[model samples]
Target: MQQTAERPSTAASSSLEIKANPITGQERVLTEGACALLQALCQEFAAEVDTLLARRKQRQQSIDAGALPDFLPDTQSIRDSDWKIRGIPKDLLDRRVEITGPVDRKMIINALNAGVKVFMADFEDSLAPSWEKLIQGQVNLQDAVRGEIEYTAPETGKHYQLCDDPAVLVARVRGLHLPEEHLLFNGKPIPGCLFDFSMYFFHNYRQLLAKGSGPYFYIPKLESHLEARWWAKVFAFVEERLCLQPGTIKCTCLIETLPAVFEMDEILYELRSNIVALNCGRWDYIFSYIKTLKNHADRVLPDRQQVGMDKPFLSAYSRLLIKTCHKRGALAMGGMAAFIPAKDPEVNAKVLERVRADKELEARNGHDGTWIAHPGLAQIALEIFDDYIGKERPNQLHITRDVDAPILAAELLAPCDGSRTEEGMRLNIRIALQYIEAWIGGNGCVPIYGLMEDAATAEISRTSIWQWIRHGKSLSNGKLVTKELFCNMLTEELAAVKKEVGEQRFTHGRFIQAASLLEEITTADELVDFLTLPGYRLLTA
Candidate 1:
């Protein structure tokens, strides 16, 4: 590994101010040097951020006019040409099992020591974007990088620490669409992507390099190759400014949107120098598929439970991801196994069996690794990969199936016969309430009914309700879904939750606020672009 120049100074700058108060002992993480670097990044790239966001809106308008996303004509040459990403870093090569969670202190320690090959410390969907949570998450990352992270719960006296050989750390920053309200430049909030990426890189890039790894990232919700190109520019600028090697910042782009699925080759080509792998963010991809085809009556999705990796559309997407990645010499990572272990012995055994089959399928499909939300499931996923690939970074098999443009588009837009059920509606209402309440309390990932529920799952739940209402979907029992029907169900579920959690905790916490937000978003005349935006406002306000 190459050494970088001397560390930058911690001198405060006049351009930016800290809008949020420092939490106890959090000043050390928000040092003057970190603020200065963030300021520089904001001032230099804020305009470009605006332009890119504007482009997203323009693209959305085109889609609303019944235009389908396809391969960019101008980028056809790059897609057709032969090219491969630069060599993979040693620490990231054999990522057969990766654990993911929010940046909570105990989660960071446990996930790193979870016996997996990689731990993605997420600041995006898995984290509730409270100002204190954001700053403290940076503190936790800094401590983990220095091998000094430890947590002792005040309630249970439980202790946590890192293992002798922890998994490689990869940070998933906020997507391009979010903004960090606490950090402002010239009276405008900084892009959340820039804030999270710059803070982690500015503080710990060299430290990670010293530990034989560099700053690895998982870029989220990218919709086009142009977006990838913009990130490449950001990486180049950050490297030049920090005096680090050009490719020190390795990234894996999450193909989570319908547009991104079509442009995988072009996205990789744009970031070949800094790219390492491409992950099928299956939950969000399904959510995006619903949102993209919102106006097409024929594209209405079935009940969320009916959709899974085995579904024709989802299977096609997964196969396409593996083919595109392997053809370009990059690792193809699989989606999450959100099933957490159940308490009942029989239930837990069944859960593990289901997860085992899922992992085996991924391994058989040539995936380099798969994601597990909880540490207990890691061994199951790891064992399947071990039995299949055995000491190899990834299998040498290639997907020879010829997936054409029409096939890819058709799969995504395919219709389903799964009927809506009253049980499904009730579950969605309960999940939205539960997830939003936990989110308001600063926990982003919550286990509900034997599955890990995050923003993506919540999005799918709420959006499905909205789509069902819009299309006048009927339940399996010959009941029609209407605003009145949903409202009646919401009321019942809310009471159930209150009774379940008890009056004291429910009243003191944000349960009511969570219910109100869920009702507002789900019942609105138009679908909101992101649920977190409104939820975030309640936090900041």
Candidate 2:
């Protein structure tokens, strides 16, 4: 069913070179026209992507050498200037609840039908970037855009189809740092996000326009306003190439990295013409906190669970984000709620209540919208937002949140208060290992221990443990977290995991490889920037 082939020459993409497995059922998505468009995107922007990535390393080296990330002095004028982003599209105004998941067909159908105001078809943290899955995800989104997306239970014969009114569809492309080695132009690898954006926009922009929607995006892991400028340029290039309006491609940037938090105002200024919102990417932000402060022993975090949104640093971050975005006429979106309704009545009630309290805090805090992993929590989020935002107002941009106390670097970087525990350490190892195993095995979003786990959460787990070891943080049980101790715990934890998942599945999955990779990352001389990068290489192995 698979065969190798060379693509036909196109005027625009004659220099494109792609080494990929046959796109079995996805040949139509990668036609000559689409490939040409992708080549153009790579040719115009891929070099800038490399330069930006190198800058990222330079900045990290500064952080590694005792330079705490702070606001850019040269760009202080942008932060202080009076400006507001361009008008938001009508469809994106009331994003009270948004569901995010990998761009698989069944998942896409369900998420779009989920009663949320928006559904983000994720090609980033929630997706395993195998070459086949990448192209197939493009094919799936094309079908969904045309309203021809469907899925049937191969075993039970039940069918699934789209509802007449589906939530607004948006795509979250992979971060700029990720590269698509399978596809290249002029001997340079394509940035993964550009590849995703180009393919989907090329294949479905016209159809989306006819349906009264445009190509919406959620940009992730941005470290500075300059990175945001890069995205703006790419969006502008696309709009010009297609002869569309300037703001046709609307985006929401995630203020996840510590460096990004310092430049919120500057980032919004850069994307003023095309961005509508700023999302608090809570999980990755936690990972970034550990990574950015890896050299500061005084800033080692407590248990991962203990570092909730209520922490002084995080609370300051949220309050600051809300104030900054509101000041610039942009929506301040909240982070994801990881809980799911359990089958047991009492347990599910507690889960719902926890999610409610979380959403209620965000709603009361003036965030215009929040994220949920499952549809079951949509009603809860909707009710909380409705109670706080009311029916007359579409959003809370009117509430500038200026009354809140000023947030400074001291508040944002203050060390959190809590105790580390051996139990939490074991849980982190299990979570990181299993998630990495599933990720490299071609599954990114997975359910482990009854919760939906993605690369973001896994990053938190991985980096937390590494930071713990690097600082020789001691657990509540009086044992110092050292390399030898970590290896011992890893061995025991691997056995416990093997026993939990059973021998059959353990034999078939990549648990051993995952454990090896986890140990390598957590014990390395320097913290691994991202576990997924090494995991991506394992896909070839």
**TM-score of each candidate?**
0.95, 0.97
Q: 1-541 in candidate 2: lDDT tens per residue? A: 1223354333236577666655565567667788767777777888898799899999989888998877788987887788899979889999989999999989999999998999999999999998888878998999999999999989999898999999999899999888887776787667889888888888888998898888889999999889999989989988898899999989999999999999999999989999999999999999999999999998999888899899989999999999999999999999999877799999999889889888998998899999999988899999999999997878889989778777889888999989899999999999998999999999999988767899999999888888988988899999999989888999999999999999999999999999999999998988888888888888745
Per TM-score, the best of the predicted structures is 2
Task: Quote the lDDT for 89 in model 1.
Answer: 89
Candidate 1: TM-score?
0.95
* Per-residue lDDT of 177 in model 1: 88
Residue-level lDDT tens digits of model 1 in 1-541 = 1122222234255666556654564566667877777787877787787788788889988987888776678877876788888878888878889999999999999999999999999999999988778888999999999999999999999999999999999999999889988766776778899889988998899899997999999999998888899999999988888898888899999999988998999999889989999999999998998887777677788789888788887887888888888878788999999999888999999999999988888888778889999999987888899988886535433543445453457775567667678898899899989999998788899999889999999999999988888888788898888888888899999999989889998888898899889989888988898899999887777
Candidate 1 lDDT for residue 434: 95
> In terms of lDDT, which candidate is strongest?
2
RMSD of each: 4.5, 1.7
Candidate 2 wrongly placed segments (more than 4 Å): 1-12
Give model 2's TM-score versus the native structure: 0.97
